[model samples]
Target: MSTANESATANPTVLHFSADNDIADIYRAHLPPGWSLDALSAAPDEAEKLRKVRRADALFLTETPLTRDHLAVAERLRLIQRQGVGYDTVDLDAVRARGIPLAICPHGTPTAVAEHAILLMLAAGRHIVRLHEDITVHGRWPKWDYRSRTLGLDGATIGIVGFGRIGQEVARRLLAFGSDVLVYRAPGRPPLERSWPRDRVRTCPTLNDLFAAVDIVTLHCPLTPENRGFVNRTLLERMKPEAILVNTARGALVNEDDLVAALRERCLAGAGLDTLTVEPPPADHPLFSLPNVVLTPHMAAGTRQAHIIKAQAMFENVRRVWNGEEPLHRVV
Candidate 1:
């Protein structure tokens, strides 16, 4: 309940932008006493909110962005700590232009995301989504003539697009399932030098080769400008007709319309997506009608464990900034 100016012991004020009340509470608890905490339902835009009133010394931004316009008015803003690993929402170029420090909680959501990817893969492969829908929409349904389908993880090649922390964790998990893992990271960046399980993974020379080789392709890369629509018609066409695709990464990485077309034409077996170009897509979206596609409302990193881990990491970054020390996960 303590407001910003009332506590004189803490000179600089800190504002947290999180819609979730529980997340705000955890952040507040970790902040040093006397440093004020203000929760906003959304990211601020106008100068008055960012500059005059909130007086944010450091910002903990959630889903919404901290754009150049937003940062322009925050004169005292020294650090922008992201709650999640992805920094797409934050304007990194502007932050770097202003010489402001930015940090991300990479360790927070990797495990949850990896687990969710595996869950989606299983759900799509076993026809769990369609079976459940049939049970609820009509009644308990019996097996159809096409029920002989089975997707075993053993001996299957799981292709991972990126070799970041989350991708590495996915590789580790899939290895335990007796699966061969193929990677398409920048060449010469071998995993053995970094202590990762290189024995279980083979590096593909290019994305095209990776797509042609694997039984299942799981995306773990960021949706940068270069890779925004990476999984378009051509890439999807190269995938084995019976191959599966999994995405716990950014939604924009896959072109929705193209994916829908591929599914309709049976170019690929199915897709399991934890994200879409739009969150909570309209009820009438075409993806809803596709029994071959399994969709989730961007909950790849929404686990309880992930929540605690992200909150802790965010606060630790704040603590380091508050104490005039270097932050652990500086991204910019």
Candidate 2:
């Protein structure tokens, strides 16, 4: 990815910060005319990052948290556009206090993120990582044991925690795999934009009910104040001993300690976690040592295709903001 920071341009500058460095080239390649792109280089300090934001007319955010301090100095900032659907990292109160519109680009998220959730479900269910390590590192081929140890999605019951676009997409894919879906929508939420097929899709009145009924529980909900760490000890204990957990959503949506305990005690089969309470968790993080866990650096939606689509949408929103129009999916 190119670090072509055309900082000299007097045109409107859009500052972008993302953990995926490869996305820089794509964002620069799709740059709107006369708009400068400042992709924050390598992991800069908080002070330096805030300094760069001072000159930005719009902030294209991902991975980085925008706090009150950053917004205090963002005098030129007119808008903040999130690269994907979740805006949990941004300080909503601070952004609102500043009266800056915060937007999220969901154009390329549903399919990629949902597909990743499926990937995790499969990998965790089958203990793919453990088998691979056993063969490669230990020189043991547990072929016979694999049959009795692993599970498959074909006949499994899956509980989907949120029924948003990504959740619905996950249900669609799971149905194709011959799995049943149990959806749990939050109470008092607005009606779904679309309905699901009745043949394999049904609603679970409560989260505990869904956890108990399914062979696998995959979380697709956002991390809000009310739901943060909702997947705690009590919830984890509700699942069958053979059931696994898959989370492609925000890491803090789960309680890391509780999840670790469940996996350690063999009360839960395994977990496929793409997001964690902390990004770049310490080397000594408990989940790092668990054999039944499959973890990624929160890259479920980090595919090049998704990033390209996100970049285009972000620039289009930037254009709209400059034209004195609201962004496409403005959340605040």
Query: Candidate 2 on 147-248: residue-level lDDT in tens?
Result: 776879898999999988899889999999999988899998765445567768888889989988999999999888899999999999988998899999
What's the lDDT for all of these models?
Answer: 0.79, 0.86
What residue runs in model 2 are displaced by over 4 Å at the alpha carbon? 1-11, 18-20, 190-195
Candidate 1 — which residues are off by over 4 angstroms? 1-12, 29-33, 42-53, 143-147, 191-199
The deviation in Å at residue 189 for candidate 1 is 3.4
Give the local distance difference test score of model 1.
Answer: 0.79
lDDT of 1 by residue, 207-304 (tens): 99899899899999887898898899998999988889999999999998999999899888999998889876888989889889888888888887
In candidate 2, position 18 carries an lDDT of 54
Candidate 2 structure lDDT = 0.86
Best by lDDT: 2
